[model samples]
Target chain A: MTLKRLLSERRAAILEKWRDRVFACYPPETASFLKREADRFSNPVAHRLTEGLKGIYATLLGEAPAAEVTAQLDEVLRIWAVQDFTPSQALAFVFFLKPIIREELAGELKADAGLTAELLDLESRLDGVALLGFDVYMRRREKLSDLKVSEMKARISGLLRRVGVDPSTL
Target chain B: MSLPKPEELARVNYQPPARGWMEVKPDFRPGTYCNAASPKWLEWIDYPYPRQWSVAEEDWQLPENWKEIVLEGMEDRLARFRSLKLFFDICVRCGACADKCHFFLGTGDPKNMPVLRAELLRSVYKRYFTRIGKALGELVGARDLDEKVIKEWFFYLYQCTICRRCSLFCPYGIDMAEMTLLGREMLASIGINIDWAMASVAQCYDKGSHIGATPQAFKDMIDFLAEENERITGIKTPVSYNRKGAEILFVTPSGDYFADPGTFTLMGYLLLFTYLDLDWTFSTYAAEGGNFGWFVSHEMGKRLNAKIYHEAERLKVKWILGGECGHMWRVCNQYMPTWFGQVPSFLEVPVSPVTGTVFENARVHKMVHISEFTADLLRHNKLKLDPQRNAHIKLTFHDSCNTSRGMGIFEEPRYIIQHVLPEGHFFEMPPNTIREKTFCCGSSSGINANENMELRMQGGFPRANAVRYVHERYGVNHLGCICALDRATLPTLLQYWVPEVEVTGITELVGNALVFEGEIERTTDLRDRDLVGVGEQEGGEEEE
Candidate 1:
């Protein structure tokens, strides 16, 4: 089976385990909340994240086009951005898919004739996902910094306007 | 070694190699700590100290006999507040409060730990006040009150927002918040005061509000808010300024009169009062509800808070209706009774005119938090509210430290929000991070100044950290709090850490949902900005 077919076959189990590992970064109680509760608002962090990660999984597995997946990719990455995860910790989740795919299709890949090439292709694809995740993380960081500047400017913007510096200049 | 960068201090749980605090001196990095008071503000306040100095200096230029001044101040506080002596004397060195502080939890700095920060003062108290500490010295965990000790106290105490979250966790009921105040009072005695707080207190005393909003300036700002209300709701709500014979005196932090989000909350107050047709007046004399003096010292708190009752008497109002604020209510609830032995005859046992519900709890203080008043009105179904007006916004209420812990004002705000906004739009940050366990806005007390933005960001991390959870997971966009300080600083902090979320005072939401009887169809929101629906129509103003 191709890597795409393999991902589809074990999609539910793979996504669940990957999400469990992600939630495991929190303390046991917090991890439980991240896993057990499913309210969109009450358990918002966990609820949005599970969906975002699942969409990224499907997009990388070629279920959807790249253009269609940027928002989902951004949503998942935005979650990691605000989280306590460092750059490596955040980006590592993308690479996590590589291992999960490898283990899930281990028996089939070994039996198939051209499977070594397929495995290499899959590894390179995971590497691409990791790179994309890294870009998203950096963009999120830059957004936060930009927000700092604008908020400071906005703080005095009103007073400045009252003082008669052209509003456009601010 | 080198000083840690702000981000490194926040991310790393790694402690610098230290044998112990006694061997190590406090380090004051630029951008992470406050500069000392300017000579002008000190002279203005008649505080005896150097006119100009910097925390960056090796010599703070404290008054001569500074050590004597500090010791005498300590002794006086110890005698006056038994709570201070109890906080100073009793500590089993329990680690419960160590990790509870938002600063310590956010920054991972050991001295930011409430126990250790208090020990900076406790260590000194051990030397001079406790017989065992003086006799045993280093063995008893006591250290001398030297210049290094003073710098250490100044750095760490001011870093504390005095949220009192740590006090709740203390098994022995020791309060690091009170200890921080005690440390500040002692330091101020010797002229080692931060400029933001001292300057605000002085400004508040002299000009009727922090930032020197004089009576005319106060009137101008109110006029501006009134105009914004007129433009948004399309209803002419004429604001009364310092008018005598009004039934209620309205007091709020001057931030409302000047700042955006706070000003929006001010617009909420005007609309609510006008909607109910309540007789009220905003006094220029007691223009500010927030007490910078309370953050500074006990004496200053008393002096600053005396204005409310004095203004109430001057206006001859029935009772004071406090606007949305945090420490404003904290001082009013916890300290007002002690400040005034009994309610002045001018102020009545605050009966909410809109609901006819008497605030028995606040009768002794003659003050009512607007949330309490609003919640009671909602309970009685007094006002016509359109909760659907806020459907586009997702909301969360940050239980402000002072309001929730200091004054036990949690449910009233939640009650108010549930009345005006959809429950599905609201999300909890984390259970542990909400209600009594709520984290601070990271810049309350007097540390809301800008010089320590980096430090505030680090201290604010845990709250932001929790907020990020809800924001990413729930698509949550709005954060509401009762405190004006929270309203002012949380937006700035959120802009830095969780850029996706916006902060507002709860009343801003309340005003948005209020349906004024026979008013022109609402076209703009309280910020005087056009809203989603109204912008689709011919936008700017009604038929004159």
Candidate 2:
């Protein structure tokens, strides 16, 4: 099985389970934009769509659509942001979803050899993409949330302020 | 990768020598025996050892003299200060803390219940200290101050391990453990102190640690550790005593300097620091981080902590780091910030020169717990790990009640294990019982209190049960923890109740896996390895 074909199948599987949740909340215009973006891919758009759909879902379901979805998405992201989960959590979530997808796809793929082969290929490629996505996201989050560096600076500043010392003295 | 042959190991006949004390005769009959299975409601008269309050046993028979002495001793600044109004009025008795108590959960005994335990002190405090209580007294259903009530206060207050698991659940954030310490202090004022409490306080005063080993005994223990380190890693660890101007000061429980499991864990910290080329020193003065005074009274707690700051000042070290001892961490991590008026300003931001990650809010002047230090070091790649050293056993970490629930240090130790150990092996005991909801090792409040043994076992039962559950489900035989009291108390309790699972410090496994400059003879005896595995012979004996 080829990598491209395997990813195509996983994309299909992810879309099947999440499509309703995604489309239910997505505005018609945004849903159309997503479909257009997804259709532009010759291979499966499963991974990109799953990752991208969260933002679109938040925008549609939130109390104020114009307000930022970063806070809500941040909460959802934190559920898997711990050291035990961080870089692997997204991939793990993908892996967790795979069997369920495969079960749903079992009937369709059983009749087609080409689709079965493609599904296997899609799984491997999706694993790599999911891992890469998790790594990039975790690194960015780590920098933004470097509490020690931020806290130490704040503490030092607070101490200096109390003693009537200025940072400008340095 | 190969298991050691049984014949290759040296046999060690390790048994604790019995200390002289009164043993209750099992066959002797009092007029009637209370039903052992049923929960016994303790009466004011049934308080154990009322005679201990008297200056002499003969004097105990003279009620007038004994009462006068008790009242005279009790009416003091020490007693009044120890009996703080804040400790008395703060509790709301929501029972949110009921299940959080390890003793109450373990025993099904209502006396071990935090609400009732605090009431023992509260009830007395109300009767004497308040206007409403003095007026109403027996009419208001509050028991009047009497010798029997004082005895009950002495017995019950000491039952608390001071783990502060109850404090986490309190809506108003009342620390019941502090109240228990205050009660113990009040009791001690009247000369109604337990041997363990008195001995611990004396040891801290005279020998500079609660375990109270003399300098010679301390040297012997260090020598033993050096020999063991040589045997394991074949490196002669240069542990300098009283070295001035070192970059870091390592403060540990004196128990770790002497006891099994704790010694190995100490060796692990020493080797890790050496491997990282970090300059650190151990102070002879601040030898213990486990403040017995924290379990007794506020003033005594401050006195014990003052030694750490005093030693740090004399040595002039940049930072202090504590070893894997529970209450010690609770004292330094939680209490030291408030007690010590100001933290030192010039202390270097403790950057894990290994991992490049720094602990931000950690007590800069006084201390950092060893687990936090190791976690930071591992994060920065300071210590190289051979994960296979931990492979012989399936491992699950029991968050010491003080470390996780009390200090919010849940992530650091788990971070250390996840990175240090092999993949898929570091299973967590149920999340409900881990982290903030961790159960206490029953005997943590004070040790060798035979009267409270049943309550201790009962309190420790939930933790033992959780470990047993994980052991069965995950085939996790190794329960790695980071507290000294847990190291001393939990394994012993498990030996009687749940015999299959073993408890050890996280650093012991790290030591076993750590590679250093020289190679040492590896001994294969499981018992000699500082792994406190329970034996089957003593199973199911009711504690006490």
Candidate 3:
């Protein structure tokens, strides 16, 4: 069977492994809360991670455009951006899929060179997802810096306007 | 140079830490904490132990007897404040408040949980003050007050916005915000402080405002606002500064003096006062309604708050008319009178001059929220309002945490909104997310500093999540609130999370909808954006 078919069959297990691994990045108490709380609004960090991962996995397997993967990762990565993660750790979840898929499809990979080549191609797509995650993460960081500047400037914008120094021009 | 293999990295242990929570030291990550207090402000204010320090450094350069100071401070507070002592003794630890905090819900940091955040202090209170804790150390869930404990206290207490959402859930009514204030007080006693709060305290002390706006600067902004109001409404709004013998002394947060959206609300106040021809004056000395000192220590908060009553007495106003703010009003409603040693003898109860309705609710406090004042006007049919002017925007109200819980002001803003906006234009966020159970903007109680945007975002997740719901479901374009901090912080929050929705002060909407007599046809809202169809309806059917 082709690698795509194998991945399709093992999608559930792979996703579960991926979910736990991503959650494990948080402190254990927080990880458990994120894993167990099912309400979308009550547990948004978990909700976004679970939902964003599913979207990413589906798009990765399908012939969807590259933008779709980035879109899927945006929400999850946004949470991590504001979290206590370094850039490497923030984008680490994307690379995490590689080993889980490899371990899940270990038997099929060893048996056929064709399947191994297909795995390599698929792994490159995962790399693409990781790069897209970097873009999303960096974009969030930039947004944060911009937010800080604007909030600070906006605080005094009224006074600035009265002083005849247009804040927007600055 | 090589990183760990993917499989190796994936092998994360999901086990709880063997060492209990007390043993886990806080990681002073860059974005996690606010900048340390500047020694310049400390020395200017003559705060004790003025020295340069950095939170990022391994050594905080704390005073040598920091532990004794913290313990003694805690003991003094416990003995002096009955409420603090009662809260410490009363927590059943039922964890009812565990999931309630927006910070906890957003960050999923277990320490952000209200029970645990308070326990950070309670554990020390146990080890140092209680017999059971001393006899059975870790067994009784107590630990010694070490340097790690101090760091943890600083980290978690600042994380709390003191919204009191947790207290609503506790059966014993355990107020975590009060405990946090106590925690922050102890921290300050040891020469520890957050810059965002302390800097503002010093500025407010020196320059009579939080942003250090001089008396002229404050008047300049108001003059500009009046000019803008005239350009929009064709009626020049009259304003006064430091004018004595006015019937009311209007005090608002300094943010409203210089922040967007807040400035619009200030315009709304100016227009309403002009329309009423109310005898009121703005005291530049008492310019700031927000008490950042409230977030620091009680003594400091009292020192900062004393300006309002003093200004009132000097100006000889009948009463104080406060603008839309969360913590300021919380301070006014709960602590101001007690802190001021009783209502000023010169100030009469706030009787609305336009409506002649005695504000019996504020009889003792002798101060009135603007919403209450406006709602009273609306109830008496005192203002000419065109609800259709707000037709272009779909709106929702976010109850400011301080007003919702501290004062129980659930209806006044809503009453004003109903009178000024189209009947169906308003929508509530959700039953659980508003009113007394309202979520914080996650940046209240002096956490709205720029350096700690990550904490603000993470802590604001629950609030933003609810806004996203209304934005998607009902197409809410405007989020109206009555808090200065909300106006300052919620805009950044919505821009990041739900870009479609915008934040506005409730009074801004009122300013947009108020119809001036003999005015030219309205064209634009206070922000100068074109109002839909208002300018076009020159000679058409009346908007009665």
Candidate 4:
């Protein structure tokens, strides 16, 4: 079978496992809220997570272009980056897919020797996506720092400006 | 845009650390917190903390006996209130409330937890008051009440909005709000309170209102509203001030007298009273229902809260009808009678004469939430409404933290809105984020100061996040809440997070829907903007 056909056939089972592992990163209460509520508006935390994973899933299936995959990585990492995760822990979910993918496609690899070569390439591709996630995480941190500086100056800036003491000058 | 979008990352990541929370010192970064309290109000309130300290400065100037003052303040309060003493002992730190605080949830700072916000003070309470804490010291989670501890208290305590949502879930039923109130009281004892909170308390104490709007200023405001009402309804709404014979004394948050959207809410009160031909008078002496005193200290809260009862007695009004306000109702419903009770017998149970609905829940307090009163009138079909007037606006109700959690006023405001807005216009934010479980406006409790915009946005994230969801789904153009501060600050909060969504008070919707008899065609809404092609007419955009 073709690589796309293999990923497509087992898509539901693999995605479910990947989603559970990602949702498990959140506390039980938060995870339950995200899991129980499916509406995009009410359950935005879940929607962001799922949409982010969908981009990754589509990329793995060769359905999404590289740019689309990067945008999805940006969207997904934005939420995870700002959360209570360290640099390593934040993007660990991306790398987590390697083991899950290897396990889910184990039968395919054993059945066809050619599939083993495709799995090797797919593993490296996952690592590259992990690198992309790291870039997004660092960029998010810089944005936060810039926001903090701008916010600090702007806090007393209104009063300072009103009183003829230009905060910018200070 | 504004409320923490997971976009404003904190420079100091408390996600993984080697040290315990108490061991970590709080550094006041420029963007994360508000500037220190202004010296002028601190001096006027006779607060004992340093007069000219700055948060950005390296050293916070402290008095020689600041520790003694704080210790004495805590000792005095512990003796004065049983709840304070009980709270100091009751906490086992099981961490039930660890994730409950919005600040902690948004910022990932453990100290912002209700468990730890109280623990910051409780750790000291143990060192000084408890036997094991003094004996065991840091091993027992007890730390000396040092300058670093004081700075940490200033940082984390300000992050708490005292919304009491955490209190609802605590297994011990320990009120973190009560603990923080005492913590802030002790802080204020040393003049360590934020200037934004003290500013309103000083104004409310010296002037009749928290905003310092004098009687003449209030009259001028009422005159403008009356003229605006005349333009809309072609009937002049009579606003009586300090009228001795008036049967009802209507006092609202001073925000209503001065601020936008809140002013529209104030207009709703006036238009409804005029429509019913109700006899009510506004008292400049008790013009402010907002008790900033509640935010800082309990005694100061009483001094400010006493005005409603004192004015009701002096004016000989049968009862008082409070306007839509947030912490105001928390104090009125839960704290008023306890603070200034055995309220004079002259005040009767507030029964709406038009609807004949006796507001039993508010009987002893002798004050009714304006939404309760309006909803009662609306339910009984007493007021003539043209909800179609507001048909152009699509909105959602954001249950204010206090009223939903503190008072269970969930259905009243929603019932009123359902009647006032065009059908299907109102949408509920996620169940976890609304009614009793509502997220705060992020700017409540004195944290509303301009300096703490970063923290405020983070704190407001859950609310704004939920709002962004609804804004995406329902194309919700307005967020209607009952609290007046929600009116004043949410516009800024929404502007930052969901710029398309605007904030409005429940009564503002009521005012727009009010079809006054003998009224001229209103070409514009209360905002004085052209309304001909706006709102329910086509699907609504921003009202302006």
- The numbered model that scores best in lDDT is 3
In angstroms, the error of model 3 at B513 is 0.7
lDDT measured at residue B28 in model 2 versus the true structure, 0 to 100: 12
Instruction: Return the DockQ of model 3.
Output: 0.50
Candidate 1 CAPRI classification by DockQ? incorrect
Task: Name the DockQ score for candidate 2.
Answer: 0.01
lDDT of 1 by residue, B1-544 (tens): 8885332332342213435767767657655787788778778767777467888878888777888889898888889889989987778886778767777655445677788888888888889998999899989898887888988888898989999988888999898888898889888888888888888988998898887878987887678668768867788878897899999999999877777678788888888888888899988889989999988888889888898998889889999899999899889888977887765777799998877788999868888999999999999989788877777678888999988888788899888888888668877777778888888888888986667766777677678867877888899898999888887789878876677898889888889999987777775667655655766565344542
Task: Name the better of 1 and 3 by TM-score.
Answer: 3
A best-first ranking of the candidates according to their TM-score comes to 3, 4, 1, 2
When candidate 1 is compared with the true two-chain complex, its DockQ is 0.10
* Ten residues in sequence with the least summed lDDT for candidate 2 chain B: B31-40
lDDT minimum window of 10 residues, candidate 3 chain A: A63-72
List candidate 4 segments past 4 Å from native: A1-170, B1-15, B528-544
lDDT string, candidate 3, B1-544, tens digits = 6676644544544334645677677887777789999988877677877778888887888899988898898889989989887887888888888888899888878888898888888888888889999999889888898888888899999999999999999999988888999889888877889899999999999998888889888888888999989988898898988899999999999888798879999999998998898999999889899999999988888999999999999998999999999999988888888998876788898899998999998888789999999999999999999988888878899999999888899999999888888878888887888898888999989988898889999989888888888988988999999999999999989878888998888888888888878887778888877787755574365654
Best-matching candidate per TM-score: 3
The residue pairs found clashing in candidate 3 are: none
Evaluate chain B of model 1: give its TM-score: 0.94
Rank ordering of all candidates by DockQ, starting from the highest: 3, 4, 1, 2
Q: lDDT per model, in order?
A: 0.78, 0.58, 0.87, 0.77
* Residue A30 alpha-carbon offset, candidate 1, angstroms: 20
Better of 3 and 4 by DockQ: 3
lDDT of 4: 0.77
TM-score of chain A of each: 0.88, 0.45, 0.89, 0.87
Per-residue lDDT over B274-323 for candidate 4, one digit per residue giving the tens place of the 0 to 100 score = 88999999998998999889988888888889988888999999889888
Against the hidden reference, what TM-scores do the models get? 0.80, 0.63, 0.94, 0.80
